[model samples]
Target: MKLGRHSPAPKRQKCDHWSPCPPGNFAYRILSGGGKERTATICFEDEQLVGEPGSGINIAIVNYKTGEFSSTNFFHMWAHDHSKQMMDFIRSAPKGTLLLMATQDDGSTRLKDYAKELVENLGSKEIKNIKFRSSWVFIAAKGFNLPDNIQREKINHSDQTKNRYKGWPAEIQIEGCIPRNLM
Candidate 1:
């Protein structure tokens, strides 16, 4: 007599199946000189699986005087590991290099920590040169509660401040030169 066929075992689910996985590739477009330009996706994975995405955040440095610009995006972990690269980009920035923060509330803490770490690693000397000199903008999908201390300090030191766009949740706009005067 023939034996009955056995069914195959069910495959186990991946832990990250439900988690939001990083995008397969990152895309960016640069607009300069009244024209639009597109760049290819920096490959995040390789055939050998030896390489991964460079970073999760994008840094754009625009040289207003010459109208030239350069930008690169890095994986979140790379920010710490590649401090020198980050510093070099910052140091090489030309006048009017704007530091913009665009992220959802879920990544706010990471963004804040990255900013703070950048400030700390760049050292007080470097920070002094760029903190107020650079324009800082924070775009959020949802309103974030700013701690009283942070609010007070920002208000006390920042030259200009604006909050959320009309009908928007909690977008914060901070402008003006650095408030070095704040103690």
Candidate 2:
């Protein structure tokens, strides 16, 4: 475990008290107890621009033990056409699993374009809109960190109301950039 911290090589795939890797690294992990947050990283490692420098990876943890969802964000442009592997990794999670994904709104066609890739590549039968906060978007499995009633309210609306959602996240916008605070 200590070696991970001292390795100075690159990223860690798993987490332990000695060596803790963040949520986005494929080797990221949690403590021995199930109560700790658990995460799995999804990477798009290609020559494509999305996988290039200045890009980052962030995963929202679904600490089911606590029934809470704390989100994170990474702003990067995805120039690829599709990512079937990423979609499969997301869908592979158990229904109650609180797996989440988010990215900053870069104010470009590429953002929506990558979103479209998700909608098309997803293998799940159920359909749900991604959550939008200031300048961010969230995609998660059904029943992911939401109570049944609130989740229903969100689902009923085609687009987010102009008003803010819980004073933080708002419904996602299909065009234009997200507000400055959101970014």
Candidate 3:
């Protein structure tokens, strides 16, 4: 439920399986990239880091540069409820607050729709720089075929091979300012 920056998550603290902190507490972290600091939201669950950025399942993207984030859960159904909290969080942000959000791609436009919905709710008054990130796939259609040279160079089947990931979130979106522009 926290939306603003706080002390970095205690990394030295043991969180796997058993720890002193309460269960479901987000462990704040600082990720350094290109001499800039980016705060990341992390939580330990099932004896593992369940909500670290760029890793784990159903993770919420956190920016060290901008103190904005969303309530995320591993389950989509559960995340829907958490997202309501996130919606409220966004509303609570003061004017000109640099807000950011990243959503999972469930093969549907729900995430995009929700982001648009948030913007629409502002009634064209509130302006925020929202950056987004999600997974994309390049595929050949039924009638389409790649040229031999291009196929040999671009057709990386191993990179495209994955059955387990398909079941994972199809998209992961992050909107907000980081240390730099990642467009």
RMSD of every candidate to native, in Å, equals 19.3, 16.1, 18.1
* Per-residue lDDT of candidate 3, residues 14-38 (tens digit): 3332234344333232111110111
Candidate 3, residue 25: the lDDT equals 35
Residues 33-109, model 2: lDDT tens digits = 00012121222111111111222123344434333443323333355422344444445554554443333322122
Which residue pairs collide in model 2, if any? 13-27, 13-28, 14-27
Clashes of 3: 12
Cα TM-score of candidate 2: 0.31
| lDDT against the true structure, each candidate | 0.27, 0.30, 0.28
TM-scores, one per candidate: 0.28, 0.31, 0.28
lDDT of 3: 0.28
Best by lDDT: 2
Candidate 1 residues lying further than 4 Å off, grouped into runs, are 1-55, 78-80, 101-183
Candidate 3: deviation at residue 119, Å?
3.9
Better of 2 and 3 by lDDT: 2
Taking the candidates one at a time, how many backbone clashes does each contain?
A: 6, 3, 12
Error of 1 at 140 (Å): 17
